[model samples]
Target: MRAVILGGIARRVLDELLRNPYRTIELRSARNVLAVEKAMDEALKLFLTYDPIEDVSTGTEGLLADLIEAKQLEMRVPWEESDEREITVCRAKVKLFGLGRVVEVERRERILVAKVRELFPHEMNMG
Candidate 1:
């Protein structure tokens, strides 16, 4: 299938690029780029094996696998600014799924903060 061909090539390219550090100069300072690319490559490879109808479904399933790991960490630990940081960090892992956009994450965090404030108005005193 088309996806299988494309995905196979992409995976090969990614593997070669990763194996050759010289190719990652663009990502020298931003290691997250590598992580994002790797995830995308994986999603593409997985997409290749499924029919068009199953593509979206399988992609979402793979994406959720990443998200569930993040959620587990979020629940297991005490909430702190660092926890927020962890969420942001974990979000990068799902970027390849095309569903975890930065704007969406920001909006979600803002909504969560607002809800928490409403539930505990006095928890943080502006004064």
Candidate 2:
């Protein structure tokens, strides 16, 4: 299942997004587009490999969605900006084996950071 997803469905999805010239306004500059492409690929890899799910979930889409959002947010940073702009990519709760887990992925200065933590069953009951 994982192989099928990464090799087929996910691959097609990534390819489509990469090929879409109008995907985002931030890709105007070739330099920025290349940077974003690299980041997008990284985001997909992180999503597919993290936890190794047999089927797709919102988490998968969320990571990509958040990455795009991060890029949009990054554009507002002035060219002269020096400080790192930390953007929240994904912070979602996913159920595995009926247990809830939190998936957090963030972007800072074109770098992607991701982490997953198994939630205590009781944690799932909270807000």
- The TM-score leader among the candidates is 2
Enumerate residue pairs that collide in model 1. Answer: none
Candidate 2 C-alpha lDDT tens digits along 25-119 = 22233323343455456543222222233333324332122233334333334446747444322222211122223255444444334443433
Candidate 1 lDDT tens digits, 25-120: 112112223333443544421111111221222221111112111111232334663444333222222112211101111122111100011112
Among all windows of 10 consecutive residues in model 2, the one with the lowest summed lDDT is 1-10
Off by over 4 Å in 2: 1-40, 43-107, 110-112
How does each model score on TM-score? 0.15, 0.19
Query: What lDDT, from 0 to 1, does candidate 1 have?
Result: 0.22
Off by over 4 Å in 1: 1-29, 44-127
Q: In lDDT terms, how accurate is model 2? A: 0.32
| Local distance difference test scores for all models | 0.22, 0.32
